[model samples]
Target: MVAGILMSLRELRNIYELLFCDGVIVAKDDRRPQSQHPEVQGVTNLQVIQALRSLKSRGYVRESYVWRHHYWYLTDEGIHFLRQYLHLPTDIVPGSLRRVSKATARGRAPVAQSGPIPRPEGQTDRQQYRRIQRLSVDKLTGVELGSKPTPKPG
Candidate 1:
């Protein structure tokens, strides 16, 4: 129980930093291909929700849904809280895809990567799956199990 709470708190902090670095956070979508929308390994969608719920209740974050997607944004309070928590000066506010600071560039993460995204090659179903002919267990080949023979067709 204690470990779970500790993990949740750590996830909450990680999520806070994510929102700090990127102005907005979008909930994970399983409908899309993972390759197209690869998720960061440390946090799962469920954990993001659990952490966001705590932040939302405290007025630190605002939530919205658009085009069947959930988006979370850090409020002013959230920014202030994060800055305070990290002992960062209040002047260093970075927006989405903005460079945080020159001094911290060594530890900075790129907001976006340049270059065309590689698309996966298409494959036919037959190429992906093997077809195996198996006998049906529901009934025998010539007659239904535990049933009298049908009357002769007239």
Candidate 2:
């Protein structure tokens, strides 16, 4: 049950990332990874629906239906949560450097007063989601993710 929940959360996070980065969610007909629309590649239509439902239940996403298709967008609360989830601080008011510096001195990381977080090694959201999926599969199969398999002595 926990594994299933974790997988669902992973899917939810992927969906949130897609909306946050791409500003929209639409499952492509082709499920190939090399598709032009990387956002929907390798993501099933059912997975998209499930993720959207989870986000909607948490009030983080809103959906619109038109012509038998569903469109998804992040709510304000969703944007706030995404910022925090990405470790981009959103609470730094202007002219608060003194307090920020004090907090830093006390060992807390200084919050960025503005601007997006610096890109770290340029890893895309798709790559991150794939990594998470790999880890979850590894956990479920009792194999250590990112670890070398032990060799048997001949």
Candidate 3:
């Protein structure tokens, strides 16, 4: 009975691992790796949806939709589940969740001064936007406009 109740998550391991690493996954942006067969390629977002739904039914993930885009967050149990699947230590911290340095944190925090905000260095009241050169598609494709193609050796 217990075995039947707790279904294996082998097939959904990729989705679980993605959540463990990213904390949260945007359904539209989710993609699985390509398979061995050339024609198989990779699974689309639909596969991600199926995996998420399976995990949700198992109480390992929570789902929310915003602006017609689905979002999934890993639950506490999901972390454990992923760790078990990956054979990782329970205290493993994902790269995305790395701690911020004190200086970086301080720079981002706003000061509580009661005076008016100061202007940034080298900036006047009005800031002009600069127009940078756009990349040329011809250059990108190695086919420069008006350039003669070299003949191949016979």
Q: Of the candidates shown, which would achieve the greatest lDDT relative to the real structure? A: 1
Q: Which regions of candidate 1 fall more than 4 Å away from where they truly are?
A: 1-9, 29-39, 97-154
Q: What would the TM-score be for candidate 3 when compared with the true structure?
A: 0.49
For residues 1-154, write the lDDT of model 1, one tens digit per residue. Answer: 1213334556566767777877677885333322222334566665665566677888888999777666888888888888987677867774764665754677766556577544336745553343211224323465545668879999
Error of 2 at 142 (Å): 78
Off by over 4 Å in 2: 1-11, 28-38, 89-154
Model 3 Cα displacement at 116 (Å)?
A: 14
Against the hidden true structure, what lDDT does model 3 obtain?
Answer: 0.62
Off by over 4 Å in 3: 1-11, 29-41, 95-98, 101-154
TM-scores of the models, in the order given: 0.49, 0.43, 0.49
Clashes of each: 0, 0, 0
Scored by TM-score, the top model is 1
Give me the displacement of residue 48 in model 1, in angstroms. Answer: 0.6
**Candidate 1, pairs of clashing residues:** none
Shift of residue 4 alpha carbon in model 1, Å: 9.1
> Which model is ahead, 1 or 2, in terms of lDDT?
1
